[model samples]
Target: MRMVKVEASVSLRRDLDTGTEMQRDAVDNIITQVIEQGDHALYTLTKTLDGAELDQLRVTEAEMEAAYAQMDEELIGALREAMTNIRDFHQRQLRQSWLTTKEDGTILGQQITALDSVGVYVPGGKAAYPSSIMMNVIPAQVAGVKRIVMVSPPQADGSLPAGVLVTASELGVEEIYKVGGAQAVAALAYGTESITPVDKITGPGNIYVALAKRAVFGKVDIDMIAGPSEIVVLADETGDPGYIAADLLSQAEHDERASAVLVTTSNELAEQVSVEVEKQLALLPRKDIAAASIRDYGVIYVARDIAEAIHVVNELAPEHLELLTKEPMNLVGKIRHAGAIFVGSYSSEPVGDYFAGPNHVLPTNGTARFSSPLNVDDFIKKSSIIAYSKEALEANGSKISALARLEGLEAHARAIDIRLEGNK
Candidate 1:
């Protein structure tokens, strides 16, 4: 890890929001094919890209049963437990439609409506994440969306992973599709003969999937254009070096583009964490990937004090922020930016990733500065409610007409004028 002094001039090496030209071109081609050829394009691309030949786009009932029969009770129980925790957490985020009436009978409020349908894309083949399934699906369910369709890449044998299948089955998500990548995003955006179009799409995928989501965003609502995973450890002298090292590696091992940074006030602790990270990397099976991530994107900043460390944190606006200092909670309110904040050594990043109640699908790179973690809000839409009574309109119609005429919208002014005349 490179050590740098905390300063206002410090900036990250990569600007993840900017898409590469290659990625944009690939996404354009993939989206074009899916829109033109529909399912045929999906099958051909799946064979070439995912190395799988599928007879159909939907997962069979027998496959679901076989997956459940193969998995042991322990993993099933754990999935259920995790599902319960996630459901409970998201249920709190469920909001109801509300209205307010003024003295003049003008009714103003919001109408919160769950989307009619949603599509969730989960990456498959070598990287199967059952926990992510829970995180993405459960919230849409909590929002009471009528239909939730799940799409994932299949193995060479044309089989979805047992754990992924069983987890979805337990969650009562029956509309599972055997597809992945940009094509899957297209199918969700514009319906194929086999699959119905969804109102929104939510989940994390590779660069191609992210690009596809960006391409289809206006046609169908998207959660966010997620970038590579990132984490920042804000610690002081009282923090444990080993814990800090382990937490950093947990995100670094995600992939080469992942970032793991540490902003601390103590120079001694920074050196100790560097040594501990090197020691732990040697023991990891994916040490090469983790090491590359640490080498390229990792940083350990030496701050003058806790205030300077917090300043660095706010400037970075990391996805996962861990306050491993002596007084973690006392520092919580001071943090203005972060997708999710992990307080204390025990509240590690992985807890929020897997078991804890909060959704793990968070804003990546520096998006935490403006965005939020995936939650029930992503699964629903809000429509503004405006109801003006006859008396209220009579009182305000002249002002409304004047403003409309001033804006050079004659039709808008006439609409109000005509309504007022009819009421008279």
Candidate 2:
């Protein structure tokens, strides 16, 4: 890790990968095929890309049973407990349809409605992330979404990993599809014969899937164009070098582009952490990936004080921030930007990623400056409600007409005037 004095500002914002020209063209072609050929395109693409010759597009009851059979009772119990924690956390974020009436009988409020359907794309083929299945699905369920469909690529043997299947089954998500990549995104956006179109799509995938989500955005809502993982540790002299090093590596091993930065006030602590990171990096199975990430994107900034460290952290607006200082809670309100803030030593990043009730699908690559972690709100839409009584309209109608005419909208002005005249 490179150590430097804290500057006026620090940033590690990487431009989101928009894919190459060839990749964009390929994604465009895949979406067109799925739109035109429907299930046939899905079947053909699965065989070509995934090498899985699936007879059908949906997972069967037998497959679900087998997935459960492969899992032991202990793991299943842990998943359930994690699900409860997640549901409880998001349930607090749920909002009810509300209205307020004025003295003149003008009713104004907002109506919150869950999406009719949502499609969660869990990445598969190489690894299975049961935790992702929980994070993405639980929020939508809390928002009262009626239909939730899950899509993932199958293995060469045409079977999803037991973990993926068992997790989705545990969540009561029955509409699982055996598909992945850009084609799966297309099928979710524009329904195939077997799969119904969803109102929104949420999850992370490869570049092709990201490009597909970008293409089908207007047609259906998407969570975000997520980038690689990022972690920023703001620590002081009291911070433990070993804990900080382990936390940094947890995110570094995620991707070669993943960033792990440390902004600290103590030069001694910074030196210790640098050595600790190098020592821990050698022990990781994904040493090559982590080493590359540390080599290219990792850094340690020596700040003048805790205040300077906090300022640099806000400027970075990292995806995952850990305040490993002596007084972590005291600095919570000072942080203005961060997708998720892990306070204190015990509150590590993985705690939030796996079990600690918050959604791990957070904004990355400095998007935390404006965006938020995935939650119930992403699964629902809000509609403004306005009910104007006869008296209320008569009182405000002339002002409304004048404002409309000021914009040179004759039709808008007339609509209000005509209504007022009729009421009179």
Candidate 3:
């Protein structure tokens, strides 16, 4: 890891992936094919892209039973426990419909309602991310969203992973489909014979999936375009070098583009952590990937003082921030940006990723500056309520007309005038 002096300005904001021309053209072609050919395009694309010849798109009851059988008792118990924690956490975020009555007989409020349907795109490849299934699906379920669909690419044998299947089944996600990539996104955006269109699509995918989501934005709502994982550990002289190094490596192993940074007030601790990171990097199973990440994007910034370190952290606005300082709690209120803050040496990054109750799908690539984590709010919509009484309108009609006419909107002014005249 490279060591650098904290400058007046510092940042780790990577440019979002705006797919290459070829990729965008390919995604456009895929979307057009799905819209024109419907289920036929899904079948053909699944064979070409995933090399799987499938007779059925939907997972059957027998498949679900088999998925459950393949899982061990211990793993099932762990998943159930995680589910309970996640459900409980999101239940607190649920909003209620509220209205207020004014003295002039006017009712104004906001109505909270769940989306009619939602589609969750679970990526399929080298690993099965059952945790993602829980993070994305549980919130929608908690938000009272009906008809949640799950889609993922199938294996060469035309079978989805047992862990993925079991996780979806455990979450009560009945509408499971074996389709992925831009085609699956298209099917969710525009209905096919087999899969109905959903009101919104939420999940992470490859570049193609990201572009597909971009293309279908106005047609249906989507979660933000996520970037690579990032972590920043802010520590002082009292911080443990080994614990900080271990936490940094946890994020570095994620991908070659992932960033892990340490900003500390102690120059001694920075050097020690740099050494520890190199020592531990050799023992990791994904040593090549982690090595490349640490070589390219990892860094340790030596700040002049604790205040300078916090200022640098805010400027970076990392996706995951860990405070390993002596007074970690006191500094939390000063942190203006960061997707999630892990306090002390014990709260490692992975703790939030898998077992922790909070949703792991957080804002990345410096988006934490303005964005937020995935929650129940993403799966629901809010509508403003207004019931104008005769008294309320009579009292304010001329002012409304004057304001409308000020904007050169005669029809708006006339609408108010007509109501006032009829009442008079």
What's model 2's overall lDDT?
Answer: 0.95
Position 292, candidate 3: lDDT? 90
Minimum summed lDDT over a 10-residue window in model 3 is located at: 6-15
How does residue 78 of candidate 2 score in lDDT? Answer: 92
Residue 152 in candidate 3, Cα distance off native in Å: 0.7
User: Candidate 1 residues 173-288, lDDT tens each?
Assistant: 99999999989999999988888899999988888888899889999999988777889999999999999999999999998988999999999999999999999999999999
> Lowest lDDT 10-mer window, candidate 1?
6-15
Please give, for residues 284-372, the per-residue lDDT of candidate 3 as tens digits.
99999999989988989999998999989998999999999988999999999999999987899888888878998989888888988
TM-scores for the candidates? 0.97, 0.98, 0.98
**Between which residue pairs do clashes occur in model 1?**
none
Candidate number with greatest lDDT? 2
How does each model score on lDDT?
Answer: 0.91, 0.95, 0.93
Ranking according to lDDT, highest score first: 2, 3, 1
Steric clash pairs (candidate 3): none
